[model samples]
Target: MMDGSMFIDEWHPSDHYMSEDLTRPARHRTRTQSPPRYYYIDFGISRKYDASNTNPLELPIYGGDKEVPEFKEDYSKPWNPFPTDVWYLGRAIQETFLDRYTGVEFLSGLVSDMMHSDPAQRPNMDEVFSQFQVLRQGFSSCKLRSRVAHDEKRSVFHFLLHWARRIQYIVRRIPPTHTSLA
Candidate 1:
């Protein structure tokens, strides 16, 4: 299904941002060191009319031309708008590329960093690429995750990850080993 990125048929001059790629797909394409495209702006009245709802999923729209609080001002309960309520960038990208690729771990953290409450703290495209490189390298073997035992073993990759996580959880809950020994 087409999302707000493609759903948008119109673009205000002010709403437009510099495109680093021509096909537009490349504009948000995943670089070797950077992350994939992740647009989280809300489109406005047009999307509302299309969806029959006031909350538009396009971030560029809602937060761009239309201010969040001002948009909600006329309503009884005024509140700032969140892109998640209308759409999820992380899930959207995951679905878009589900059949195309594997190892989507970077997306989760990328989305978190991009959707930080403070835009100032958000990573720029270059920084995103740098961090993405590290994350991608860190989980490079995720796709190769598997195990075998006597030619009859379920994938211990997932199982081991789950178990390891539980161990870490327990370790965190327990006091430091050195401290206990001391």
Candidate 2:
């Protein structure tokens, strides 16, 4: 069972706790065995409507209809990208793989490619399938640990590179020294 919290956690979109229970109250040895009960209750009207109108906290259901102008798009683009986070696949991977993805590096790369901000960078489904096949072959071998080692080294390299860039930014932010006038 997966859910999209969107914004609220303890409560749903309507700004109220779901008084309605998600499951039948059952007897069990411990609370840990029970499945989490997440229900949609909060009507985050603001999410649907603009902030300026949410203050009243109610939408006029009857005659308040109006046309919202759609944003113009470039016809040449192959895909119309979503304006929201594409995090559902990551969650699905965690659930499906159970954190034991054989080709962890390859899967990470797939996720990264999917999450690339530029639509042009995203791989097509066929390319993704081909890459997965290659990764599966690498993970099946036990004799050579090079594949896993490569991932570790790459992670370290990226970490160091990020750190170095951050340090450079901080140094650049430092005030310049004033020369002595003597």
lDDT tens digits by residue: candidate 2, 109-167: 66666545554455654565666666655652232222222333457676676456445
Give per-model CA RMSD: 17.5, 22.0
Give the TM-score of each candidate: 0.28, 0.28
lDDT of each: 0.40, 0.39
Q: lDDT for model 2, please.
A: 0.39
State in Å the error of residue 17, model 2: 29
Residue-by-residue lDDT tens digits, candidate 1, 129-166: 67756664564232323121222233667568645644
Q: List the residue pairs that clash in candidate 2.
A: 12-42, 13-42, 13-43, 13-44, 14-42, 14-43
Query: How many Å off is the CA of 12 in candidate 1?
Result: 32
Candidate 2: residue 74 Cα off by (Å) = 12
